[model samples]
Target: MINYDLYIDGKWMASTGSSRIEVEDPATRQVIGSVPRGTKEDVDKAVAAAKKAFPEWSRTSAKERGRILRKVGDLMEQRKTDFARVISLELGMPIRHVEKWHLKSSIREAVYFAHMAENFEYEYEAEGGWVRREPFGVIAGLTPWNYPMEQITMKLFPAIAAGNCVVLKPSQATPLCACMLANIFEDAGLPPGVFNIVTGAGGEVGNCLALHRDVDMLTFTGSTSAGKEVGALALSTVKKITLELGGKSPLIVLPDADFRAAAEEAVYSVFMNTGQTCCAYTRMLVPRKNKEEIESFLAEEAGRYKVGAPSDPDSDIGPLISKRAFERVKGYIEKGIEEGARMLVGEVPGEIKKGYYVKPVIFTDVTNDMTIAREEIFGPVLSVISYDTVEEAVEIANDTPYGLDSAVYGPAEEAYEVGCRIRAGGVHINGADAHITCPFGGYKESGLGREGGTFGFEEYLEVKSVFGK
Candidate 1:
């Protein structure tokens, strides 16, 4: 079992490691590792260190910072296998999926930010004076467990590349891989205090970092409710905040669309990561005339995502993150049944007694007003809601409090047109292949700011106009 201490400044110590939190493998319900339970004091020390390192680190030229960021990405790419193994072991993502999606995507994000850091427009002449974009000094990054490597790097790489120091608080359930990443940056010769890791419950460590006076900005990814609390705490000090929160995103299939392809892709979108994804397209909208056909297609595709231990290479899906998540998802399934939504396949018990596995569930006869259709059930449960017209489909799609992402399936012209009407940060035409070149975020309660590409790199900066300098 791996035991990790708090990473503060350039050192790893047990000063605030008096308590410990066990990391478990959801597939086997086994204890894989443990990390220090950081306290408010630990967060303070981390913030102080980041604050101390900010001036000098931010003063470094963008080219130098870009070089260091690129080195970090290179090291990550070299050791990606190691990262994939640890993350899969802890989070129950299939090894193959972790390797294919998590590792490569994170490496690309880092490298993308590396190039943007140097080539980004930091200063440009204006009518009266020149506008300068400066680093926010110190950043507090609070990340979730679903996409461990990507979430951490998305916040860390851009913040650091923009010359801001960071204090990261990763989900305690999946800290080993994050701990390994901090070591990777250290190995890349990141300056002391420029990057720090404190592992603990978000209520304590996360709240402390957000409310810290020295911390200049907060970037968070998690549930919408938790985001509200984080935003409120940071706003107390009027600190800069970027939040990527929850979603009940929709996938609309027009009457003329290929029913099989739409249903299959919708299954992948909701079932990927066992539906723990924040922007999962859980609500699938289809034409009322073809409801039966779509339901049949969904059932067939649902059987394809076999759930098993994370170590199995052929496994397409794994267990939920923990027993709590398993129960939560299971409860959502039961609620769907209670609300009169018909289940085409799967059950509330959801099979598999050993692991926290939740079998894929496809709900039909679902109305827009049903509880299952409205709430964000972070599980492999897809709610199929039928619409009479494309206009009503667009209306139903945008009815949610979230506008994170959506997918439209139809002919090129109609699909793109429907996508245009859908209110989301991103709208995939016919597939759900992850794209990094575009900005990713939400319109309303889904999130406050965008992440990905140049937009993400700019989130760490603060603009100032040098008057006639």
Candidate 2:
């Protein structure tokens, strides 16, 4: 197994304790790697380093910062294949998608943020006064395992480009990518201590980082329940915080759309990344008259997405991240049947003796109030809810506590108009392209702050107003 050490103050050192957390390959259930199980002591040291590095780093020229970040993107491009393979092994995503969705997106965002930093107006005149965007010191970032490589890159690129130091605590289940990234940053010539990493349980290292007095800002991406705990801890210090939490997002297939294409889009939204995506379109709202026809198309599309090992070139889907996650997805399927939702595409499997795999599930005749329709089931499961009217479809779409990502499949004019009514942060109309420069976050309980483009970059910055500057 590959063993790793905690990275603090530009050095990779063993933790204060001898404990290490083993990371398993979801496809094989074999221990593929291990990282030091960090303690509060480690968090303290990382935070101290970040806090010490913040002053000079914050004052460094944006041009210089952009150069380093741009170099990081260049190096990541060279190792794209290596990064994709590791993520496929650790997170159970198919190799075909890992390169396109995870690694390429990370590299693109890094480059995008680098250019943004170079041209960003840190200070602008506003109504007879000058407003400045200043970096917050010692940001504590916690990322989830679903998109291990991209998640940390999503936070780190902009946060560092904004001239803030960060102490990141990646999910212990998939941390090898984090280790790889730290090495890249070092190679990119980032100033010592401008970035740090501590890997361990959320309760230990994450908790310490959240409440650490030196941390001026907190950014987290995970489940809603865990986010609340972290947000609470950060609140104790009254630090600036951003939480990108759970989502039960929806995809509305309007009457005017092509049933075949819309059905395909719906399945892709959920089955992509094995449905571990926080912003996945779990709920599908279709017109009542076309429900059965659309259901048939959905099932057929899902059938094409076959499950196999991540190493297999043709595998469309792979295993879940862990046994616990596998069991959780199974539990949700059982619950869907109990709630009287009609099973269209999936069933609870009879014990498979090997990998943590589950058949993709789709439930029809679902109501907004059903547990299956409302909760965020982070698996390859979709809830198909039929609506009588366009207004009803919009209402059902907005019924959930989450308002993350969503989509509307219909004629151009109709879809755009309907998309505007949804409460979600993003609405994909007619298979719109999702670039790295869009503003991404959620409304309501799904999240607190944006994570891409101009708004996201501003999250790490504190606003200042200077009169007659």
lDDT per residue (tens digit) for residues 1-469 in model 2: 7678999999999999889999999888899999999998899999999999999999999999999999999999999888888888889898988988788888888889989888999998899799999998889999999999889999999999999999999999999988999999999999889999999999999999889988999999999989999999999999999999999988999998989998888898899899899988899999999998998899889989988989899998999898888888888899999999999987896675678999899999899999988888899999999999999999999998989989999999999999999999999987786777788999999889999899999998999999883
Q: How high a TM-score does candidate 2 get? A: 0.98
lDDT per residue as tens, model 1, 1-469:
9888988899997846488999998998889899988998898899999999999999998888888888888998899889889999999999989977678888887778888988998999999999999999989999999998889998899899999999999999899999998888898888999999999999989999889999899999999999999999999999999999999989999898899999888888889898888878899998999998888899888888887788887899999998888888888899999999999988886554778998888899999899889889999889999999999999999998999999999998989998999888889998856577778998888889989878888889999999895
Of candidate 1, the 10-residue stretch with the lowest lDDT total is 345-354
Q: Pick by lDDT: which candidate is best?
A: 2
What's the TM-score of each model vs. the native? Answer: 0.98, 0.98
RMSD of each: 1.3, 1.1
Candidate 1 similarity to native, TM-score? 0.98
Candidate 1: global Cα-lDDT? 0.90
